[model samples]
Target chain A: MSITQISVFVESRPGHLTRTLEAFAEAGIQVRGFCAGDTGEYGIVRFIVDRPDAAMALLAERGAAARTSEVLCARLDDRPGALARAMVACAQAGINIVYCYSLAATCIALSVKDIASAEAALADADIDLVDQAELARVLAGATL
Target chain B: MGTPMPAPDQIDFSALPIYLPEVECTSRERIRAIQLAKLIEQVGYTYARVPWYRDQMDALGVTPADIRTLDDVRKLPFTDKSALRETFPFGMFAVPMDEIVEMHASSGTTGKPIVVGYTAADMDVWSECIARLAQMAGVTAADRVQMAFGYGMFTGGFGLHYGIQRIGGMMIPAGAGNTERHIQMIEDYGTTTLIATPSYAMHICEVGEKLGFDWASSTLERGLFGGEPCPPRLKAEIEARMHITCTDNYGLTEVMGPGVSGECLAHRDQQHIAEDHFLWEVVDPATGEPVAEGEMGELVLTPLDKRGIPVLRYRTHDLTRVTTEPCACGRTLARMQKVRSRCDDMLIIRGTNVFPSQVEDVIGRIDELTPHYRIVVDNEGGLDRMTVEVEIKPEAFSDSFEEMSAFAREVAGKLRNVLLVTPVVRLVEPGGIERTLGKAKHVDDRRR
Candidate 1:
C-alpha cells in the first residue's frame, strides 16, 4: 500500500484553516505531518494523514483542487557529509532533488525526481531508505 | 511658387471659442490673417525645429516658402491623435520642458499614462478661451458658477475651473462626486450657473426632487454640459427639472479639453468652432478630403497659435458639418452641428458597424431606458452580437418575458434602420446599470 500526501488549495481568509480542520475532524482523519504555507492571497495545505482518500473527498466537496504527490523520509547520520553522500549517490544515478525539508536533527524528508528509478537508485546505493508501505503502516498503526 | 492664399470666408467662427487661443488681434479677419502670417512662420520654425513635422512637410513638398495664407494651411500635413501617442509624452511639445507649467493626461497605454504639458501661456490660452466661452453663455463676474466635472488628470475639471477664473467670474470649483454637497454649495453660494455632464445634471435633478431640495426652484439658471452626448429629450428634462438652461460643451484630452466648442446663450444646439485661433475644416471621413459646404464630415482642427505643442490639421474624428447661417448670439464664428459620433465609436456586428449614438438617440426619446443604458458586445461563431441593456425602473419590467422580449425587439428594429444591425434589447430593472460620474461608458467589447 502506497501512502500518498494530499495537498489542498485554499484561499487565504480568517477562519479558513479552522474550517478545513473541522472537515478532517468530522471524517475521523488524524493529520500526522502537516505543512501550511501562504502565497500572499492563498495557502497550500499539505497533509500526511491516516486516510488520504477520505480527506481528499472532504476537500473536493468544498470545491477545492486537491492532488497527491509522492514524498520520502530518510534518517541520516548526525555527522556532516552524511546527507551529502546520499545526494551524490542520487546525482550519480541521474536523480534531481525537487524539494527537501528538514524533518529533524537526524532525519531529512525529500520530494525527488523519478520516484521509481530513484527508488531503485537508492536501493542500489546501499542506503537505508523508508518506502511508502512502511510509512503508511506506521501512520495506520499510530495511536492518535 | 506660393499657391494663392484664399481669404477666410465670413462664416460664424465664434461657435467654438474654447479651442482658440487669444492672439493680439481681436476680429476673426485680423486673427485669421495673423494666423496666416504665423502659419508661414510656423512652417519655417517647425520645419527647422521639429524633425517629424519636417519629414511630413518634406514628403508633401510643402516648405516654409509654400505657406502664404490660411488657404496654404492645406499644404501642411494633417496630424491625428495616434501621432501624439506615437510621439509619446512630451516628445511632441515644440517648446522645452522647463517652459511647461502644468501637465495632464487621460488613461495611459501599456504603462504610465500618455502626458500633455501646458506652457504658462498655454494655461492662459486654455483659461481665456473657456472664459470667452462662459461669456458667450452669459456668465458674468457677479454670477456664481458651480462646476461638477471630475478633477484630476481629467481635462474637463481644470479646463472649466481655470476658465471661470480667467473670465473673472465667481467660480466654485466643485469637482465631481458628492451630488448632495454640490446642491448644498449651489444653495449656500447662490450658484447661478453650473458646469457638468448633462446626465449628471439630470441625476442631480432626480435626487433633488426626491429629497425635496427644490433644485428646480433654485436660482441655478444655466448649465454647460458635455463629456457624454445628451440627447434632445434629456437635455430638455435636465433644463426643466433643474430649472436651468443647458448648453453643450465638447472637447477631448487628445485635442485639449472640454472647452473646445460650447453653446452660447442663444440656445443654439450648434457650437461655433473658433476658426481664428484654430483653423477648422470638415473632411469626408472615408476619403480624408474636405467635404463640400453643408455636407457632414469629420471635423479636423489646426491650431494656428498653440505653442509648445502646436498641431496642424489634427483629425478630431468627431463627425459634424458647418453652416454659414447666422447665429442669433451675434458671433460670426461658423456653426458646427452637434457631434454625431466619433469614427472609432462605431461597432461592427456580423458585418455592419454601428454607433451607440444611433440607438442612444431613440433610447433617450423613449421613456423606456430613462437615459441609463449599456451596450454589451460578445462574439459567437465569428459574428459579433450586441445587446443593448436598458435600466428601466423596476416598475417598468412587465411580468411577461415575452412582453419584455417584444419590447427589446422593437428597440432592436428601430436601431436596425439607423445602424443596419439588429441588437437584442435587455430590459434591466432600475439601477441595474451603474451611473458613471464622468463619461457615460456603455460599450463593452468582448469580441476576439
Candidate 2:
C-alpha cells in the first residue's frame, strides 16, 4: 500500500520557500519529512504530512499549485543493515526505485516505477510495508 | 500549404504599378516646387486663422512671408505634444467646430489625450494619401480588405477604411479582436488583404494554427501593418507563416494617423513618404539642427495640406534616416529607414502604446506591492510579451500562494484598464529584483 505526499510548485527565489513553510506552520500541520529541488527558474517542494487532506485544502485555499500522489512507505529494523537488506531484495527482484528519503531512523519513504512489484518484493523479504495508519503511528513515536 | 509563395529573389518589384504616377514618379525638382508652394499656402492659412500659430510666429518674429523658400521653414517655432496638451479639445483647431467633420485622439502620457480634428477636405487628403499607400502595397479594387484596427477614437480604422473604399476594394469592417472569427472570415469571405498591427497578425497566425486552419491555404495575400514598429525579423516571420506579403506604414494622431509614409512592394526595407502632403526633416535630437543627408536623427514633420489643425515643424520624436536616392520602383519621394527605437521611454506592446510611468501609476495604487518593479519585454512565439515583476511587501508576503496569485491578477486587470494592453503580472519576494545605484533601470527590453 502507498501513502500520500503533497507537492508544491514555487518560484526559485529567496523567501518563497520561507513563505511555503510559513503556511505549513500557521496551519499547525506537522511535517514528517520534506525535500526541495529546483530547476533554476522554479522549484518543487514535496512534503509528507500527518494530515494530507487538510494540507491539500489549505494549499488550495492559498492559491497554490499543490497536489497529492501515492508513494510506498516501509519500516525496517533499527539495525544498520536492515535498509541494505531491503534494498538488496528490491535489486534482486529488478525493482527500480525512483527516489527514496529517510522518514525516521528506521523508516523510509520511496517512489518507484513499479510500486506494487517493489511492495511485494519488500514484503516477500519479510520487510514491513507501512500504510497511512501505520505511518501516523510510527511517526508519532519516532524522534526527528 | 496550398501553393508555395515565390521566393523573394523571384519577385519582380520594379514591375509593380504606381498608384499616382504623376505625383509619385515626378521629378525631384517638381516635387520640391509642389511642396514649397503648398508650404507657403498652409503657413499663411494657419497664421491668419489659428491664434495659436499667430502667437507662435509673432514670438519668433516671423510671418507667412518669411516662409518664402523651403529652407526658411526652420524659422517657424517647432510644435510638439506640449502645445497640443496646452490647447486641449478644439483650442488648436484652425477651423471652427462646425467645419470639423471628424475627430480622433491618441493616448497621452497622463490624464487627457492629444486630440486632432479633420475637416472634410482634410479627410479627402487623408483618403487620397492612404489610397496611394494601399496601392503601393499592392491592394487592388478586386481584393477584399479586412480592417482589424479598433474603429473607436483611434485614427487607424477609419483612415484605412476610407482609403480602401477610395480604391473600390471590398471592405470587411471586421474591427479589432475576435481572432477565431477573424480566421473564419478569412477562410469564408476570401480576405486578400489584412490590416492590423504586426504582433496581432502573428497572434492570428497562432490562433489559426491551433484551430487546425491552414493559413497558407487561405486567400490572405497581403497585410498592411501600422500603429507600432514592425522589426524586420517579425515581418519576415509573419510573411512566411501566413504566406502573405507584409508591409509597414508610419503615422501618429498628432500629425495625421497613418498615410504619412508606407513601404512600396518594390522596396520593403524603407517607406516612401507622401512628400507632397507632408514636408519631412531629420534633425539632431539635442540641438534641433538638421542632420546630414542619410544620417539617422529625430524626424520633424510639417503637414502641408492639413486645414483643420495645421501644425508647422511637429517634432515626432521618432528616430530614422531619410534617403532621397531613387528607389527601384521609380518613385522620386524620399524614403525613410524603419523606425527602430524612440527618444522617450514609451514601449509599444502589441499595438498599444505603453509608458513605464503608466506602470508606475498602476503600481502606486496597489498597497500590497512595493514601488520597485521591473518591466521586461521580449518576443515569445513571434509576438511581443510584456511581463511586469513587482516586489511584494514583506508584510504581504505572508499570504498564501493562492492569495498572491489573485492579487497579481487584480494588478494586471487594473493595468489593462489603463494601458489598453494586458501584461503578465508576477509577484516577487521583497528585494527579488536587483537594486541599482543611479536612475534605477526600470525596463529590460529584449525584443530587439
Winning candidate number (DockQ): 2
Off by over 4 Å in 1: A1-144, B1-32, B109-112, B345-448
Give the best candidate by TM-score. Answer: 2
Q: Residues B143-243, candidate 1, lDDT per residue (tens digit)?
A: 78888988888888888888888767787888887988988888888888888888788878887788798764687878878667876777877766676
Q: A-chain TM-score in candidate 1?
A: 0.71
Q: Could you give the fnat of all candidates in order?
A: 0.00, 0.00
Chain B TM-score, one value per candidate, order as shown: 0.73, 0.77
Top-scoring candidate (lDDT): 2
lDDT of 2 by residue, B1-448 (tens): 2232355466576665577889999999999999999999999999999999899899889999988999889998999888999999789998879999999998766868999999999999999889988988778888899989989889999999999899899889999999999999998898999999998999999999999988878889889999787867679899888988888888889989999998976567789999999999988776789989987678999999999999999999987789999887678899998776565776778976576766876887788777888999999998999999887664454323445567778999999998889999876645667899645788999987
lDDT of 1: 0.70
Q: Model 2, stretches more than 4 Å misplaced? A: A1-144, B1-9, B345-448
lDDT of 1 at B248: 77
Error of 2 at B396 (Å): 44
lDDT, candidates in the order shown: 0.70, 0.84
